[model samples]
Target: MEAHALYELLEKYRQGKCSPEELEQLERWYASLGKDRPDSLLEEGSEAAQVLTSRKLQELHASLGRERRVVPFRKRVLRWAAVVSGLILLAGGARYYFKPASRQGELVKEYRIPAAHSRHITLPDGSLVILHAGSRLEYPLAFNNNIRDVTLVGEAYFDIRPDTAKPFVIHSGSLRTTVLGTAFNIRAYEGSPEITVSVTRGKVKVETEQEGKLLAVLTPDQQVVYNNMGATAVRQPVTADSAIQWVRKDMVFENLSFAAVAQSISNRYHVNVRFEDEGLATCPIRASFNGTEPLETVLSVVCGIRNASYTIEDENDILITGKGCLP
Candidate 1:
């Protein structure tokens, strides 16, 4: 089930308002969570693994209410709704895997994007991440018990969920960024000369990971570029929006047929595209867009690369004419 549905169902359970069928469904879900796993093939987000996490979470609320003299049971469970919602997403359809964490106590889940591609990620905390090509992000399987922490490689733009009590932290190479709530970008590729942190909204604090030395406190439109080898950093002002312009529909087509590109363009631009010479559909095109160009501009570039020309028959239909694929 979806996160919202799970949440509504949880509320119904807490209110003692669930029908027998709903309760039966909940039991089946829990049964699935407790399912046995193949001994040889273990992985994070596995049903058995989630059973441990879910059990711990459920136990946490109970122990708090019993031993810690915590709030009432109902109230405490209600308070845990946020945590539960995030867990539902983990079991939902996010692409991720687990790695050994620093503490060695629990595994950290990681999401990676290969070179020449980008992906959008919704963190367990509901924060948004636009991971650029050749990047990876690592975080806990569930962001429930501790502060929000993540490790980044390469680059990504983050729109963090605001939680004043718990700060969000990112470790990118030697640089560490801490913020309570903000939108920012970090570019720190391996073997790169430097790591850069740019803030678009709210405030951000940049520091050295090892020594915890303060580097810079940045506000909107500000950024810090740190020379990793030299351990020197320069803080400056910039057009923050420009830094994030790549978060748009930047895409790459590697050795793709014109017909495939046409279909993709049509899907993206909400238009129909056709070829006068069917042979032209076989032409291979390799191109990348930084995402700022308009549809016409993109099509013009694509057509030029293929030694072809295109015309707009109507606002929604495009016609292309060209010689067959050039050698």
Candidate 2:
């Protein structure tokens, strides 16, 4: 059963609307969770964990009846915390049971992309993720709770599956982005000067995890840049597709200088690029590459555009020489 379904069933039980069979099922599921190992709930201060503890305590009090001496609220909360933590840990197993016919679990899985390479992953919920070079994504094998949560490091593009009842969330460094099934790109590489999130479809809510403060709510073609050094964020309009150009391996240049173009190429191909003449660095380039073409082919075209020539040395270093662009 999905998290939303379980939530609805619990609500019905609370309201005394469950049938006898349904009540039995709920009791069985709760008993199974009670048997889970302790030490699993890591986010004790989180709202969700608090809610779980409260609910467990209420159920326990109801079961024990007024004849039994009431435990202090503080003591009850501590005991329930252990129980809920065990439940969460059990949720990470490959198969946890609500019943024989309805087994569910959300085991965590992680993926990492090496330098100079990219990878594509289809999550358990059918969300598509394109992980850029030097990035890592940690997601669950299944989404079992009220939220779909994942963590990202470095850069990645997400095409999320829409489920209004469960918001998809990405935790990157200190930033948290929440969306209800949208397409977006995030760049949050460690040690980077800034973290940027750009939306292509639907909307996204960005926040600071530590303070739970809202930073920006962005729509299509919108982006937010968070400066790590200044601890500030700014929103701006941007061409959304351009933000994910690397996913398609499409190199696009619109009136960019040779220096900028060289840097882009160096980053993509993991090479060092240099202009032999300082003047040539200022030459403008207007071009597009599908990335299917060889690096040499792309370089030849760029050099040809400015009446320049290039030489490859030591397999990874590139040198360009030319008379600067037309005056």
User: In TM-score terms, which candidate is top?
Assistant: 1
lDDT of 2 by residue, 1-327 (tens): 344445455545433367887767655554444333122332566433533454564565355333123654223323342233334433332222121111222334556554576655777788888778879887765788789988899999899989999999998987999999899999999889889999999999999877988999999999999987888999999896698788766378899998998877775655568888888999889999754345688799999999899998655568898776557
Q: Given candidate 1, what's the lDDT at residue 240?
A: 75
For every model shown, what is its TM-score relative to the native structure? 0.52, 0.46
Name the runs in model 1 displaced over 4 angstroms.
1-98, 101-103, 249-327
Stretches of model 2 off by over 4 angstroms after superposition: 1-106, 250-327
Candidate 1: residue 192 lDDT (0-100): 95
- The count of backbone overlaps in candidate 1 is 0
Residue pairs in steric clash, candidate 1?
A: none
**lDDT (C-alpha, whole model) for all candidates:** 0.73, 0.71
**Candidate 2 accuracy as TM-score:** 0.46
